[model samples]
Target: MKRLFAVMLIILLAGSMVFAGGKKESGTIKIAVAGPHSGDLASYGLPTVKAAEIMVEKINAEGGLLGRQVELVIEDDVCKPEVATNTAAKIVGEGVVAVIGHICSGATKAAMGIYNDSKILAISPSATNPALTQSGDYPNFFRTIASDDAQARIEVDFALDTLGLTKIAVLHDKGDYGKGLAEFAQKFLEADSRAEVVLFEGVTPGAVDYTAVINKIKNSGADGIIFGGYHPEASKIVSQMKKRAMDIPFISDDGVKDNTFIKVAGDYAEGVYASGPMDTTTNPLTIQATKEHQEKYGEDPGAFYLNAYAALQAVFNAIEVAGSTDYDAVTNALRTSYVETTLGKIKFDSKGDAEGVGFSMYQVQNGVYVELK
Candidate 1:
């Protein structure tokens, strides 16, 4: 009787262990999506979060990977560096396979160390500071959009060759993304061509008043003005420029490519030229996805949505290729494989950065951003 009882106990214990292992294997794959869901730059960050959510939904509905549904855990970093670092740590603690976020360059830089130490991949959709990818320590970092250097070159060429402008003024908000692009533009314009920066200045972001800065640009004798910042301050400065009767042609980078700029600046946004990645609305898949997004959320997708969507696609593709949630496998797959996304085919180079991509120029016409041929 004792021998028979011992045999039954061993069998029961073995069966319970098998059940527990199966339950663990069937657990959901978690991906963290961090951005400024609330704050001054929420216009850019919220869309990124929404785009990631859309990608997760699509992936899950199409039969989730490895027979486990994917889940997105969102955290708001408020577009601040300190908050970004803490949010990244919290996401890592949650055991997510990867993170997609820190839309601003400064915030991304802040969270880089945390992500590096944790061995999780962080793919940003909108952070464009050239220095972010230039650093050798951030092996897990990736971006879908072109860098500021590429966009700056495009803008500089357009200003000098297309517009035939030789004298220009450059301004930035002193943030990593803003100042980095501005400095690049200044150097490229001055050294690469006859174009000169007649004035270089910095402005505090979220400032309520910019009349003095506008006046300074107006008096600098510059034929063109290039701004490196987001829509809020850009709109304010442009509005002040018009109010002060400074009619110099205004140009900017991708940071200003959103409807919020037009809404905030109103008609003052007219005639402004900006360059960024191609608009997703121009793509059929992106258009369809955006329509569904509006139907569900009751709002149009923002500028960074497509790029964010692409980043998420890349992450999932990496996971599918890796065949497991193991960090090293996913990271290896991400570095070696190419992902076809709405943005185009994405492949990371040795440094875990995207290959060279360019930006398109757009002009505000009749309150809409019309792509310039």
Candidate 2:
């Protein structure tokens, strides 16, 4: 009986040592990929999640961070604000090491408080609303993309100087990102005094038909349209404009830069311009990432998938710098460190915004998208 008792005690101690970190040492760590996985904005959401998957695969092949493979826990929030808040709570509950999303600005904003309180780190690939990082409230939130206001400035300059269109109309989806970016451009345009914004309007998102809004844009007699919304609606508006024979050029903020935009608008999308933060085709790292992405998924990467890959790069780099899983330590490391990513060198400032921000312009020509000098 004494011999049996000693053997049992030794087995229990070994098991305890393996699980001492509150989970089995299975050589795996669970992170989250949260966003609109099943809805219209899934075009925006899917890219980041898929990118995270690809990144994890690569890192695992090279012996993942600290010898633990990354396992993504996907949760779909449908890009709804309330759903996002709920999703954040669930992610935190799952004890995920970090999140790669809450893809839209509204979703990020709604979930920010929960993430902040829980000390759950979140890095969005596409949420560009300034408040997500500018408010200084979401210490745990970070993003790979530039703020909407930053993109708006470049877009406004192009509309006035390059397009030489003095009369412009601003349209938004009324969500946090759309409205904020639209108003940011309008505010700057208002200050310019050289350009005149003839109309400012908001369109209800997820609407099947926007002929009413389309007619409004046509009748506005504006020389250009600046849209602060996603691709689906922007495609409809531009397609309708084509049918109405309105040839004025319109520029879209990054939200509508996906290939789905061209697919939705078809031939009508020709000559329409969209702005993005980085061009994956040109960046050497992005070229490799894109090639790997295509080989794994059997399709070209989404418009912003590189940014998502960069987000993972940022998150993993921070974890490596921190050297531990403690929330505050990891959070502080992210806040203060400059991490190199596929997006080039990325460093977060005091407000948790990425430094060295800029935008790239893209236009649909000959039924394909290409970077505009």
Worst 10 residues of 2 by lDDT: 18-27
| Candidate RMSDs in order | 8.0, 8.6
In candidate 1, position 200 carries an lDDT of 93
Model 2, 1-373: lDDT tens digits are 9999999999899877766565724546778999999978889889888898888888889998877777889999999998998898899877788888889899889988997887788888888887788788888888888886888888898898899888889999998888988998899899997898999999988888888887787787788999998988898888888897889897997788888888888999899888886654566777788888889999998856878888888888887898766777777887778876778777777787777545878889998878787
Prediction 1 TM-score vs. true: 0.63
Candidate 2 TM-score, true structure as reference: 0.63
The 0-to-1 C-alpha lDDT of every candidate, in the order given, reads 0.84, 0.84
Error of 2 at 93 (Å): 1.5
lDDT of 1: 0.84
